[model samples]
Target: MEFLDLQLVHALKTDGRAPLRRIASVLGVSDQMVARRYARLRETAGLRVVGRLNPRPVGQTVWALRLQCVPSAALGLARALARREDTRWVKLAAGGTEVVCHLAVRGERERDALLMGRIPASRAVTSVTAHRLLRLFKGGPTGWDGIASVLTPEQRDALAPAYPPPDARAQPVRLTDLDHLLLTALARDGRTTHAALAAEARCHESTVRRRIAHLRGAGALFFVLDIDERSLGGPSATALWLSVRPARLAAAGAELARHPEVAYAAATTGRTNLLATVLCRDDEQLYDYLAERIGALPGVDTVETAPIVRTLKRTGSVARDHDPADGAPRR
Candidate 1:
């Protein structure tokens, strides 16, 4: 990817709904050029700008699950998990036998049933470790600041969403069967227009517009930007397991979230309360981050780092050897 590619991603990470013309104006490029670059990136990189729901604020729960399976079954199982709407993030880890993913459920009962019933019964799964996510330090569109240097503050402000205060988050929404249809469409493409959604949901266009706005304002939906890290010239991603003192967990988490290297970080229930994904240019830079940054943080008792070998699935896009000429991930 070029400098312009990174700028376009940064702008979209701020606002997935921002018009192409607006993005072009902010970047000092023609709308057609911006559109062409986006098309190329999506075509070559398996990029996805998706509308995702933030479950936490809506009385929902998220659990980080690591499934250890036979190496032969790992990719297929990961694909199955990725296809499920309830399973948000799924990745085949560096240790080829393990598949790491998040299960976002609406209620405690649903979360319990999934862990105790369906997963354990799977013949391919040898072991299951579920960690309840207690708090989110990052891991959403708003937290991806890795491209911060590419956009000016003024440009960024123009695309950012209005983040209401913690106390102001909307309550869990009551869903009609039809609401699920609207959400399914949004999940695939957040930028899917209202008229299209109405046609799909078999509802009036005004109803589509009202429902979408309500969901957005109700904290039931949010936008996330996903792009190929290989194309960005920085492909290495690491998952860090951190043990922190109970008293200082919040402080340590907040501090860790401030670092641009962190793509996803959260407090979970397990021996390691903190799990984070760190993005770096290479091994040397990763060493620096783990040492000078994470190691320097107060109350961090211990840390274990695992480099992600390849991402099998991101938010909504699965990794394939898209650039078939070389038979490799797009880069």
Candidate 2:
């Protein structure tokens, strides 16, 4: 990707909803050039742009799982785990001895059962360790330095705006303890039936339905979408850290939140004041995103990124345990 390409990515990273004309003006290029480059990046590289939701807001729990496996079996084990619908991101690290996976789930018990019961049964997996994300200090794609320099004062003023319009508000509803339990259950399995949730939550089936409706109305529950990156030909995912002036935090975060490639963006406390995550198609796209898109945002002084070498766990779920049905342990 060219220097200008990085600028476009940064602009998109800040605001996926940014108009092409705005991007062109910022880069001192025509809208057609920007559009052409973006198209090429998407079509040739299989890069995708999507909005990511915060798991916690929707009652989904995130966790990281670390797996120890035989060196040769690591790839096979990762492949099998990745195929499961519950699995999100998987990483191979520690010289192939460790496999980390991010998982999303509903409640602590079910998540525990999955880890202790299901994964240990697999012959490929030798051991597993899980950690819940207590608080998200940072997440997202790296910023672009090249574009930061390219952005002129007027361009920055034009690009950086106040908050985008708020999303539609869902009406709130009262929830009982059973309601919380049911919501937690469905958070783990979006497709779970009312009967299943009722059984787990220890409530009547009709109560489960009512509580679900109330939770949905309150915007406390949401459907989980399982995306197949391989099917889309996208490469692995990465998280980025950005340090920006405190005075500019809101503007920077608001802009970063709009990028389609960015799945999560938030202001945080630390050396890197801002965090964002991005999904790409390959190394080329990742490079382009970091160099062009992320580097260009206003008020960003520096960007640091670490590729998720492995997802130990995500959304509070385990990777390996014995299969409850078969009584076979997952390796």
Candidate 3:
């Protein structure tokens, strides 16, 4: 990616649905130039702006599942998991023997049926563990600093959307059939026009716009960038499980969230409460990140690193069920 391309990406990270003219103004470029770069990125970098639902506010419990599968079954198992609507971040790690993913379920019965029943009965999986996310310090709507810092403060302010603080007294919003249809279209392309969404949802364009605003205002929807990791730094990333003292866990997670390399960080119910995804250019950079940055964090006891072999899914449903050849974009 070129410098201008990165800036455009950063601008989109700030506001995925911002018009090309707005991004152009922020980047100090012509609208045509921004449009050209964006089209080129979509063609080459697998750039996708996804409007994802926030499961937390919708009575869903999110769990990080790690399945130690037979070496031959890792990719197949990962692809299968990625096809499921309830899964996200489906990845192969631990030298291609472990399949890791995030799963969301509405209740204990749904959670147990998969976690305790079907998954445990699979012969290809040697073992599995589930970590319920207790609190999310970062990830989801939070843009990673690595790709988010290219724009100047003024540029960012120009692109940033104004969101009101959450209301504790507000009632939880339920997902309607129209909401599902609109989200399905937006997940494929977050910048999908209101007319397109209205066509699919069988509603007026104004209704589509108002419903989208309502969902976002209720803290039920936000946008995320689904760009190729190789465009940022490298083809792979490492997942870290840090055992931090409970007294300083919040501080440590917040610190990790600020690191440019960290794409996601959260506190979980597990032996190692702090989990983060760090991106580095190479093995040496990964080593330095573990040794210098993570090692210096206060109250961090032990850190476990699992270099991802491949990530099959990030934010949306898998576009294809088959694995890609090496060096190809996984999107």
For residues 1-331, write the lDDT of model 2, one tens digit per residue. 5667556555655544356787898878998998898777555433333323345645556666667888878766775666665666666666556676767686778687778887888777887766565444234222223222345567655765333311223333445677656645654544466788788877788987776555544445433222223323334667666888888877778777666567656565556677666777677988988888777777889986656544433332323434354453321
Residue-level lDDT tens digits of model 1 in 1-331:
6799889888888888778899999999999999998898788766668877777656778889888898888767877887776787777775768888888897768887889998898888999988899888887754655753589899888866665422214575777677778877877787788888889988899998887777777767778877767666765888888999999999988988899888888999998899999889888999888889998888999997766765656775555555454454422
Which ten contiguous residues of candidate 3 have the minimum total lDDT? 320-329
Candidate 3 lDDT by residue in tens digits, 44-131 = 7788799987877777888998899999878778888888888978988999999999998999999999999988988889998789
- Between candidates 1 and 2, the one scoring higher on TM-score is 1
Better candidate by TM-score, 2 or 3: 3
Local distance difference test values of all predictions, in order: 0.78, 0.59, 0.83
Any residue pairs clashing in model 3, and if so which?
none
Report the backbone clash tally of model 1. Answer: 0
lDDT of 3: 0.83
TM-score quality measure for candidate 2: 0.49
Q: Which portions of model 1 miss their true places by more than 4 Å?
A: 162-170, 320-331
TM-score of each: 0.89, 0.49, 0.93
- On TM-score, who's better, 1 or 3? 3
Sort every candidate by lDDT, greatest first.
Answer: 3, 1, 2
